[model samples]
Target: MSWQQIQPFLVALAIGLLLGLERERSHTAGKLPAGSRSFALLSLLGAVAASVGQWTVVAGLVAVGALAAIAYLRTSEDDSGTTTEIAVLVAYLLGALAYTRPAAAAALAVVVAALLVSKTRIHRFAREIVSDIELADAIKFFVVALVILPLLPDRGLGPYGVLNPAKVWLLVVLLTGIGWIGYIGVRALGPERGLLVTGLAGGFVSATATTASMGRLSRTVASPRAPLAGALVANLATFMQLLIVIGLIDGDVLRRLWPPVVLGAILLVGTAAFVYRRAIRGPREDLTTEERPDIEPTTASRPFALRPALLLAAVLIVALLVGRWGTDVLGPNGAVLAAFAAGLADAHAGAIGAATLASQGGITVNTALTAIAAALGSNLLVKCVLAFTAGGRRFGLGFLAGMALPAVAFTLAMVMTMTMR
Candidate 1:
């Protein structure tokens, strides 16, 4: 027999064993009526019937459901949940799915087994850990990102082919999503570690938004020090990402760029370390305390700041239009200007553009380096302005101290490189 002929049955049997193992464990706990043997048979039964015809799978379902119903009726009152019966039905369907897509079926079976194992944690989190408002915000973010995002047109709209609704909405989603990420991190690791972790992760997504989210969060916390550290840590991702982009697109540009980028990154690390040290010494609300305060503690206290994200997106939309219109007709020199325009809001945007153009031989390496510097400089200024605007003086001052000195070093390095020629 061909491999294709035997693959589905073999895969179905494996999936059955995996699902059955979880059920068998539950059965030992007296919470489930089905065991490893029953689940394995059900999966094999599905595979055998589905092999016969599509309609045979339906017949298999009826027979399985009938058996599951009988099992349910016999289950004790204390353990009277449809979980086992539902699993039985799902195991059979997974077997049927394996007839065509064995890989997808196997992957889903693992997820199902994991869910079974995580019952206690999931119950506790849903019942106790997550607040009504936090859950609601999570649902809203999902609806926007998953449901609404895909529905918008992908092409650029409005003036200068700059306003792509989907892309713009994605930025808005990103802003809100960064906040959620930080919130979850804080919940998992406590305030100081959480913000630091999420800031590093969020920077890869959108450093500016991460900075804004952290800055805005600084207002709620007793000390801005931790959030300030998070905001500064996010810049580390900016440098690393630029290096990756430049290296991939143009090696010469990467060589030209790495010095200032490295210098700036080293400075950022020292600044973040200093801020984090201060955060540890400062007064902070115990985020994971058992005693519930009237208000939530530290970072979780505020709802994901949606209004600011929307306003930032609005500002970015204008930047995109102005950037596009100003540089669209400029050619090579125009690309550099475009990079500056893009960099005003996004550190990587213009730098990537310039590097890509130089790689294509549209401009020289030195020109690409210049454009990149312009972009980075413009973006640094934006981050500074946003730090004050979103986070207040303490946050802003922390941001400036972390960012400004490194920026000066970067410019001096660039200028020194020039005069040497």
Candidate 2:
């Protein structure tokens, strides 16, 4: 037989085997449904039926359902779990899918098998780990991203074609998604894993928030080592996020910025590591992940930052408008000024504004690059102030020391990238 002709059957067989293995392992105590051989045969029957005709496929499914129903009825009512029954139906469908779309069928079969395999973990996560509020938040996220995003007019609206509902809300969704992931990470790991994990995750969502939280922790905690270290680490996200902005807003900007941004991140990581080591002076502090201070960076049960996300969305939209208007009115410096102002509130907005403007020919690429740097510098300025005011002098000094080398490295890299251009 030709490879094309044989491929679907092979895929169907593989699907049956995968699901059967999981079900067989899970059926430790039940007078259960079909096992490996039975599932395999069922899948083969489905493939054969599909190959024959539509009527054959329908008849096969009906017959299989009847047999499955009979098997369920014969088993005691006390042992009435429908997972296997549902899986049986899915297996039949996957087999049919395999006939026309073998690759898709194989992928879906793996997903089905994984679901069956992770039954316990999924149950635990839904019931024990997830709270009602988090579940609601997840639904809200889905509605916002899936439902509303599609409905929003993609074309620019409002002043100077700056306000595009879909695009602006997309920015909000991206920010919230990042925060939600960080939320899950911190909650799953808990406060036991030291502030390093917390810092990095939180920073990815909002470096300013992370820096402020770490700063507050520094003042209250016995040893400010973890807090100080965490604050320094949070800035790593700022540098990394530059790349995310450039990549998303403009490819040309990404091509120019990636090297410097990547090297800067590495430099920051190395610098943060040095500080983390120095700060962990005793066992009570952040000496180890398992045995560390009782400081918790993750707040209780919040899935994502709603207000800040909205605020950042506003800032980003304004930045875009400002970049356009400022350039039109006052030239390149206007874009730079707008970027710096926006960066003080949120650097992502600034970088995005600059790259977006450059892509649109509203400003020269060189101006965009300068604006991005200004944004970063201004954002750093705000962070420095936050560290000093919120974390106290020692934490502020420590954070600065940790950042100094990395900042120098980042500046040099940025200069080289520009000069090479």
Candidate 3:
């Protein structure tokens, strides 16, 4: 027989052996009906029977099920589960599948074995790690991302053709997903690691929101140092995300943008590290303690807020309109202004629009870079304002130190690159 014809039977046997090994390993804990040899034989039976006819495979499956039932009855344990029996039936089917689709059969077997092995970790995560509210929020996030997002129209709509429902919903998903990561990190790691973890993670989702949240926290805490450190670090996400956004819009733009952006992020991180050291070493009495009056951490209550995500969407929509209008009215100059304005709301929107324009040959690469840089500057300024308004002077000043040096470094990098070109 050819390799193809003989390969299926061999695969079927392998699948059975793999599953049987897992079942046998698990058998130490309980009275499992099937073990390595029994499962291997069951798979071999399915492959041989299916090779004869489809009906033979079905009959074999039924027979295995009947034998499993008899085994369960003989054991007569009230608490006995049917997992092994179900697995036996699945293994038999996989053996049959191996004849026609050996690759699929092997893949499914691996997946099943993986699921079996991961049982403990899965249970531990579900039972102990994830909170009930987090689970509910995850369900909601899925609904929005999968159910609602797919249903939205993909094309741009509205008077100026600025609104694309799919894209808008996509932003919602992206923002919420980013925020959720930070929320989970902060929740899982606890405040012991404090602002550094929270800020870095939260920055990915919404640096502005992180700034506001951290700022608010700063006002309530005795020291304001931790929140100040976190707020500064959160701005790093802004530049990091800029790289991602521009790369999505135009690779050329990203290629040109990365040098300055990366330099800025490194400077910001260095500044944040300094502030963090100072904050951690600052007077204990000046910091939040169990006895101190502190604002309840937002990460504990919700993974990501629906209201903020929707508001962000609203801001992006406005930026889109203004950006399109700017391009139409003032040509390239208007585009830069639009980017600056949009950057104040969200740097990503401005960068994306500018990059799109550059990609379309409507603007020069230099012009596109300028627009993106303008947006970044505006966004940073907004963060600074938020630090002052929400976190007060101490937090604002601390954040200023973190942000200013980076801004200077980035500006110098941009100038050096431009001059070199």
- Give the whole-model CA lDDT for all candidates, comma-separated: 0.74, 0.80, 0.78
lDDT of 2 at 254: 84
Instruction: Give the poorly placed runs of model 2, Cα more than 4 Å off.
Output: 53-59, 76-78, 287-295, 299-301
lDDT of 1 by residue, 83-136 (tens): 878999999999989988999999999999999888888887777667788788
Instruction: For candidate 3, give the lDDT of residue 40.
Output: 89
TM-score for all predictions?
0.70, 0.92, 0.77
User: TM-score for model 1?
Assistant: 0.70
Residue 78 CA displacement from its true place in model 3, Å: 6.2
| Predicted structure 2: clash tally | 0
Q: Which residue pairs clash within candidate 1? A: none
Candidate 2 deviates by what RMSD?
A: 2.4
lDDT by residue for model 2 (1-421), tens:
9999988888888888788878888988757778888888788778878899889989989999998888888764746788888888788878888998999999999888889988998898778777788878878888878998899998878777767788778867876777777777776666666687788777877788788888877765666787777777777767766676577777888887887778878888887777678667644654434443454555323776467767888898889999999999999999999999999999888988888788878888878888998888899888888888888998888777777777777778878888875
User: Worst lDDT window (10 residues) for model 2?
Assistant: 292-301
- Point to the candidate with the largest lDDT: 2
The TM-score leader among the candidates is 2
